[model samples]
Target: MSADESSQATALITGGGTGIGAATARRLAADGFHVVIAGRRRERLDATATAINVDFPGAASVIVMDVTSDASVREAVAGISRCDVLVNNAGGALGVSRVEDGDLAEWQRMYDANVLGTVRVTQVVLPLLRRSPRATIVNISSVAGESVYEGGGGYTAAKHGTSVISETLRLELNGEHVRVVDVRPGLVHTEEFSLTRLHGDQAAADKVYEGVDRPLVASDVAECVGFVVGLPQHVNIDTLVVKPVAQAAVHKLYRAPIDWKTEA
Candidate 1:
């Protein structure tokens, strides 16, 4: 799309303060979209918006929002005149625990954020999206949704919900000129996500990447999102699964051999 076309588009991204959300905001802004970054952290949101404005100049805004709250979602959506694109990226794992020994509170939190949060934001934004000439909705799911892993009970289930919602919306919005796409990513390195899953244990977060040659970064996923959103309005990418070269699948990965690099 040309700069003139991009300037006419408006995109709203949830959880835009950090990680994949922030990366998507930056990518979209670079694409010439008027981007709005929404999240609960006011300071982080301001920082992200400021960085975008300084770098991209008049391409971004920040909205303080909590996706889990209906009022917050409604207010945030209401503030925008028209939403050309909606990115549901404000969800994450609460904790890593077996189902039997899991904390019910943690499970509930995951459901509220991962499932209901997406629902709330989508609900508020649909009307505005419908008004756009070429509208698109992208939901950030995970590989965990397609395959279960140990200690991923709550998070996997929540992501599965997101995947289902995306599929159903695609069917419902078939002829509405609004495309719904789902992007499921494998292991990604992000501070807030790993920190929350490990219950604020920084060491646990660090250990997740230990011994791996390299894992997928937030910007990688953001690039995938941008690819989907940048396609022709008539072209819709239903679903996309992205992973690092080291990650083959949810249950399988090719870790580096200890002595191979040294020998080479």
Candidate 2:
């Protein structure tokens, strides 16, 4: 095969139906990649694929996939002939609960989604990635992975596991010419994520952003992925931490000072 044909990169992104996943799919397709978007929602996946196809023309496909299910991940990866890029982006918090008051079930759910889900998808797609001359894996980690916050113990622990996995995978794949990249973003405003954590409490979800002027949007993170993926084959960005200007850290945010004259 010619270099162009052989190097024609294809990207398979998990949770690509919405949020950062959808944004990444659109960005990747626009960057001339043949994109395959996978997620649990067939309707949303179809919509994302259609939108990308319309915008980029012959650059998008959709697959119904549940990352937490091994069988589902196996089937999805088996169907793909090649994958130059695999973005493990399907993960979120369950609820904000203190360790003492945390529900074991909720913690388990977070672990399954954030840790096992990533492993299942990566395990199935590694072979296809290895087949390519230039392959890259981008794991969507979080700032919480690096630090703990009040009422974030369960979710933070899971993300910490994800961070460790990404690091270990990089070492394991060192000789295989497969690049591993981890992007950790802080305070991204995504509907499904907050909604899930709050258990469909719209008011609770809304409160998450009430005072924030601008938080990191899905597109912001997506652009970072695009930049990493577009780098030369020899260049590998191991880890990138992105956050909004207002966010200093997990517990630090620039809030408006309390004042009587401040508009409510």
Candidate 3:
């Protein structure tokens, strides 16, 4: 909750106005990094920045940028003097339709946000990261990238592309001072993720966790990112998959109620 006098690392987190992005900003700020949270919404971004700065003092800032645009990302990074870490987390799913009934525009939007947006931000920020004493790039992917389901075609494909980006970057940046990490989380119950995916359908969003208990929260994934970035430069976490106990796999979720009374 307090700032560390010696913590000078600067981290730029995209989609940082809310959800996992906002949580990671707080986590990194608490870890003593000067956190810049970038997103498209000014209101949400300002709110998050204000909250973080309250806890960590002036450790938090906001950059209003659309990751999907080169000019926006360029402008956003222009003011960033140094960047020791980059967290690519600005992406979402649009709808739950099957492949046959998929919306082309929605699919393209997903691809642009999840895949190319990461590419743009990384490309522009590579120089800043390269200049750092030690740098880390954390890509926020999903277990859906590794598994398939009925209504997850577009999102799965996009996230798989994100996975490839993380993998290829790690290989390309080999022997460099930078560390590339891929964090894939499963069944996270954020306030807006499911709602956005369902296109503001409250009922549909609620059903996502209807019978589930203790689904992964945004802070859980944020903690993983914090831990990964906090490691020594010699350590590179290639890929990490985190899921709740209720979720055994992408296709298998334990929905039954817990029976606390039992014999050992």
Candidate 4:
């Protein structure tokens, strides 16, 4: 890609290997922005970029980055020269335990990934964003940030911190060129989110959405992000909450009986 082509517009998405991050990369590329997909998984990032490039040639690339590591993030971001949009999507829940029974190490890891990760990546990219004529920052938060439930203390706390970052950054950059958008999604059933949260316990992860018809998928959230970023610069969606109809709130899930024949 040449400098003139890159000047078309650029978007850098963290956690871009899988789930919402990957989906958002595709959406942004389709919207005519050069998309930089970053994550720790090199193969996954490459695959995502490949798919995006097939549809929107020369519009996608990959950068292997671990948002949790300060050095790794700085090094990965150093190569990027421009950013019209920054999607802070590299975050996850670590465990499922109450506050008293929580593992201290897991709690710390959650905070590191979900909160500090956003801060680290956002800080490095803000300068690039400012250089764009119309810049926007999309922070992928969770409904957990807005409300809590049993055994959700640690993840909830970290998401709350993410919410705080979006709110505070918007205020601090009030007259600045960038727009801060916070997207809170509920009951999003990404391929790896629940499994990772349950420490690779498949059965436990399955139970998280068992009997639910259809939870929000990665593309669904990506659509929201794409829509928000494509809006006119003067239009800012400060906070948007998206949830499956089966989920009225964090604790309120309408479950249906599973059909064994259908599964078979």
Give me the candidate number with maximum lDDT. 3
Supply the global lDDT for candidate 1. Answer: 0.89
Better by lDDT, candidate 4 or 1: 4
Show model 4 residue runs off by greater than 4 Å: 1-5, 257-264
lDDT per residue for candidate 2 within 1-264, as digits (tens), equals 234433567999998999999999999988988888999999999999899988887688877889889899988877777799999999888989899999999999889988999999999998888888769999999998899999999999999989999999989878778899999999999868899899999999988877876788999999999999999978999999999887888888865533335667
Task: Write the residue-wise lDDT of candidate 4 on 106-179 in tens digits.
Answer: 88998998899999999999888888877999999999889998899999999999999999999999988789
Misplaced by over 4 Å in model 3 are 1-7, 259-264
Candidate 3 C-alpha error for residue 183, in Å: 0.4
Candidate 4 global Cα RMSD = 3.5
TM-score of candidate 1 relative to the true fold: 0.93
Error of 2 at 20 (Å): 0.5
lDDT of 3: 0.93
Find the 10 residues in a row with the least total lDDT in model 2: 1-10
Task: Give the clashing residue pairs of candidate 2, or none.
Answer: none
TM-score of each: 0.93, 0.93, 0.95, 0.95
Alpha-carbon RMSD of each model: 3.4, 4.2, 2.9, 3.5
> Each candidate's lDDT (Cα)?
0.89, 0.89, 0.93, 0.92
- The count of backbone overlaps in candidate 4 is 0
Relative to the true structure, candidate 2 reaches a TM of: 0.93
